[model samples]
Target: MSRCVLLRCAAAAAVVAATLVAAACGGDDTPTDVVLVTHDSFAVSKAVKQAFERESGLTLRILQGGDANEVLNRSLLTAGDPQGDVVFGIDDSVLSRAVGGDLLEEYRSPELSTVEPDFANPDPHVTPIDHGEVCLNVDRRWFASRHVPPPKTLADLILDRYRNLLVVENPATSSPGLAFLLATVATYGDPGWQTYWRGLRANGVRVVDGWEEAYTQQFSGASGSPGKRPIVVSYASSPAAEVIFASKPLATAPTAAVEEGCYRQVEYAGVLRGAHNEDGARKLIDFMLSERFQADVPGSMFVYPVRAGVPLPEAFAKHAIVPRDPLQLPAAQVDANRDRWVARWTEIVVR
Candidate 1:
């Protein structure tokens, strides 16, 4: 769900203060706190947080270290002496970089046995929590009002009609942005991806720093005041969020994801190396994989739980899309080429 933090109104301070205040009021004589350092997109209902704290006998503290890339970058800088016990929201887009930098401590959870094999991490270092597809989400209303068909594939984004109608996050700063860039690479390959980016630039695509700005400000399909851009880089599950969070109860979402060029993203959590509360950290990871957590995933974060049998919410079941053949590049390939690709992308699109 962190592919696009679905809670449009919740602020980072609000999420932190709520969790911290609950921990402070807890009646434990000597409370042991396990810190979870993750992206700003992380969210869970208060009930779920209280349940985890009570069940595990651990005070759960959260440290939202910005977006996924910011979280990973901060962890890499303080690799051994991490700021928290567990780090969540590091997806396949940057998982190899985290492992290569020795940012996580290996702690294979028993809960992993129930995870869908497709979402399982082969390495014991990280546990997959949830998965989703990052795709171009369009405002169906916007297209309809203009009497123009929305773009359906990566190739369609560069068309003349869609010019200045698409907004994207900068891959260097955002995970979904990076996943989208990888999607282009997986779709167009090498020189072709570069050409595609050049075409996008020529077609007047707008690039923002992160998902929040692109989706909430520039994207037309968001709940509040609509922006000019009809299409944006966002999650496949975003439509479900739109329907659930709408001002009024709606039968359907105003937005829809173009599944043809979607990119699959699997978010993971792991114990940080040299954590003060390693035991508590492992417990937190296990709790994340528990049914209570996974079951709340769709409503809380707008992502599909990695646990195979977790049922989806009505909104997700009705409005969300699961791409049949989402685009993906192996972690090793992404890790090796990420820097060069980002630099080239900046050159083509930003510079």
Candidate 2:
């Protein structure tokens, strides 16, 4: 099926499920199953799900609610009659809104003790599962063939030499785009971010709607067909993913992330406020933070585990460079100013 058709079908299913959940909330027909509502990117091994169900004695259901923003918005809209028992993929960019809306029930997991102290939940409403860096991925061959040096910093993107060589996702539509925008805001501050974006626009930076198009279609690094743009806004782990998914295993990645422009994104999972199976929801959250799940994270999700001592896949350890000081804005600041920033960004960059 076509991608648009698939998205439409998924959306229709979500709406129908939401209606059923609303009816269940109004009546006595509470669901016995523990439903996990998450973004399209969420994944877990079948073994993991089976183990959770076997131990918890509750049927597990997963709902892919479009994207991170969509999933969070759906949970907020259905706060008291949530479509699922647990919600995952709420990142730092949207966490404050979820907390402020009272969409989640506070349940601190005991498994958190093994997670890194830096990622510890400051608020009990949500628990961090995995983290990744949003950064610029460069096509090594693209620059090497031309004997041109790759841009090293955000400032380098707007240089005359780099014109028409970069592609970025739309902040209003793409998670990585939003994260990258936030990175600029954190790096350059409010007024400077607008200036930087204007410079990029003048330098011929192309903006696409989402990561898949930006990476697979426009990015010369990954596109199997003829591609133009050499630099794409993507994940630090993207290089590792390229190596892991290659048809014939690659000794090294063809793409590399520019660590200087990286933005840290931490994804969280929380029990919905009025879930039918709160105990099971809590168990699911705990399981996500467990060693077994953390071990599965790198290969399955291409993200770093939040658990302190979990070993990374060899591909990630060798190819991905975790930024020592990734740019980040406070959750409250992002929550308060996100819409305005996105709007201004649209005006400057998209228009």
Off by over 4 Å in 1: 1-31
The residue pairs found clashing in candidate 2 are none
Instruction: Determine which window of 10 residues in candidate 1 has minimal summed lDDT.
Output: 22-31
* TM-score to true structure, per model: 0.89, 0.90
Task: Using TM-score, give the best candidate's number.
Answer: 2
In order, the Cα lDDT scores of the candidates are 0.90, 0.90
lDDT of 1 by residue, 1-351 (tens): 663475644576688877865664453434378899999889999999999999888888899967888889999999999988999998897889899999988889999988988876556899999998999999999999889998988999889999999999999888889999999999999878999999999999999998989999999889894588989999999999998888889997999989999999989999999987788888899999999999999898888898988899989888999899999999998988999999999999999
1-351 per-residue lDDT for model 2 (tens digits): 999999999999999998877664444555556889999998889998888888877678999969899988878989989988899999999999999999999989999889998897557899999999999999998899999999999999989999999999999999999999999999899889999999999999999999989999999999383668999999999999988888897887999999997999999999999888888899889988988899999988899999998999899999988898888889999999999999999999877
Question: How many clashes in each structure?
Answer: 0, 0
